[model samples]
Target: MQPETIKTQQPDLTGAAPAARLHQVAAFAGLSADQTAHLAQPSNIERSIADHMIENMVTTLAIPVGVATGLLVDGQEVMVPLAIEETSIVSFVTDSARKCRPAGGITTSMSGTVMIAQIQLVHVPDPYRTRTLILERRDEIGALCDACDPTLLRMGGGFRDIEVRIIDTAAGPMVVLHLLIDTRDAMGANTVNTMAEAVAPRLKEWTGAQPLLRILSNLADRRLARAHATWRPADIGGEAVRDAIVLAYRFADADPYRATTNNKGIMNGISAVVLATGNDTRAVEAGAHAYAARSGRYRSLSQWEVDAEGNLCGSIELPMAVGLVGGATRTHPTARVLLAITGAKTAEGLARIIAAVGLVQNFGALHALTTDGIQKGHMARHASNVAIDAGAVGEDVAQVAQEMIARRSINVETAKAILAERQSQRAD
Candidate 1:
């Protein structure tokens, strides 16, 4: 028997009622026809056929990835697509965005893309000789690299600067070449790596420096993006709220133990979208934490300050290297759909949206910790899963889950209790 060939389909938006178009995902099932059409617009429908190898390599499982709605980014309403299974992440970001809505939402900006390429030079007769040789030949070397990617140059993007370093490592004394390239709108990793590899032969001929590693580095400190928001004192008014928020930031900043977890809260939303859309989450994480410790200390990813007017101001700056085209973004079916949803023009535009989502996520955690407590809200959403696991069906799943939470017990034990109680009453 031939297995079904699952062709990717969009909710048909051609004159269909709005609620009728949200096809695959259950989360969007309740949306109106207008909402479905808006979501299913041609701009948001991205499709790609998976090569058999690609399907075999990455993962065989398809996890539920949903868009976090009610987001107002840069005064624009957005539905953020997040590809993660963890409970509370989507809800947390949505809650945070709602809190920030009155403050005009989040504003973000990115440094124009500057990517790094690393070249390792080994077995040099004299380390200083190779360093001087490379520096002297920089313009020639840069020109050679620039020629390899003419399209980038035509678009006002190409090699901008060259740097060299001599390091004494456990292996031996080695010289390194650093190529700084302005990538413009795309994630410059592939661009920079190609240019670096193109120059390796020339570099060998000049100084006899054996190039070992010709690759792009993820430490995109030069390509940083930042987002900031402010909350009124009246909005956070009570002493407990103020103290708890400040304490949360301080704890993360003061202790590396806490900072990683704190940053994880921010990445919960950021990474989900990154993974769903086929962006390199590992590279982004590596660059982010490395940049965080560039000052020689592992500190918090965000800073919190109280203004003279007593408003709580928060800001975050981190290395974010993301692209809208090429690599996984173009290859994956859903990743393409995610970019279509945003209608973003450039990679930097997407980065700003990502930063905004991170800020919103942080706000959600801080707000919960400062007020009602994180577990209270998180457990509420988690209850449904517990009910389902406990064998509750359809509507009864939510009912049993809510009842369990209302009684301050939302565990397997509680779920079982509710199930038994309901079954007994029905039997009577």
Candidate 2:
């Protein structure tokens, strides 16, 4: 006899209710009824909004949102909401901010909110001549680009300048047009991309060059955010600790291996706020890393040194391509609340806040690394997670975690053993 064949039906989830969609997905995946209901539990974001935010939407994944206090940016005391899963980041930032508060907190400034859009013109008969031709038609090109977004122009932002360059590539020599645009209070990816597309055809018509890859460049060199802070030796564990931080920064500045991790530490703070505000975290991260490597050698995004007062000073500069409008910023309810909490009225203001947070976060990491080490504090904070993972419940969770930390052995195995001991004692 032939073997029995079974076929599973794929449910049509289009236009289905959120609960029904969950049930269908669970059934298809052979999940139990309890599992299906668990997946349908209400979250901060409504199902309809999650469905519209992206295609083929399932349930929303929730990340813990914590606030870091004592951050004084530009002479304003601000509490920043960070959406992240990592342990100790919020606590470390808060501690770092407290240490720097006596030194006037963090002073920040932004270069501008300018974003670059690149239009690659290939197969040009005369690359240099084509570049000049495009530059000469600046007025016409600006008019076309500005026409794409009249609202941006009305808001005191739009086409600012135009640049053309001819460079040799593996394929051949190509002329690239850089459209410098001030996006104002927005991240401007969409604005600049639309402008590039709007003006690409005109360039092709004028120079008989093929227009390819018209898009916004994430490098965002024109949109730089900077921050600086000083920590007195008395505040940061004396001169020895301060000098050690400078040496640690030197390692990152000299070696690419160290730089990658060092930059990641900065992003831990920047990306958390970016996610909390519904900004483009990936864009900000890409711009930051690219800016770090602009000198051909990847180096630390932040600098640390001893100031004239024998205090440790830290500064960070990176491209902050974030926006206060558009995308999920206005749509997501939690993001709107988080943005309001930061008290940033403009894109530049938000960029400055993020830069300050990055600098302080870098300082916190260096302080921990140069002192008792990172794992001590990090693992201590993570102990509760290990306790829960080991099946400790309610009050037992904290007890087990505390015991693990006291013993300096934070692991799931140890957590389980401790929980077992507590249960045995209770039974006795």
Off by over 4 Å in 2: 1-42
lDDT of 1 by residue, 114-153 (tens): 8989999998879998899889998898898899889989
Model 2 is weakest, by summed lDDT over 10 consecutive residues, at 1-10
**In order, what lDDT does every prediction score?**
0.77, 0.88
Record all residue pairs in model 1 with backbone atoms less than 3 Å apart, i.e. clashing: 18-32, 18-33, 18-34, 19-32, 19-33
Q: Single out the weakest 10-residue window by summed lDDT for candidate 1.
A: 1-10
lDDT of 2 at 110: 96
Model 2 TM-score (2 dp): 0.90
Misplaced by over 4 Å in model 1 are 1-48, 52-59, 237-240, 424-428
lDDT of 1 at 391: 90
User: Tens digit of lDDT per residue, candidate 2, span 39-73?
Assistant: 45556678898899999997889987666767878
Error of 1 at 257 (Å): 0.6
Per lDDT, the best of the predicted structures is 2
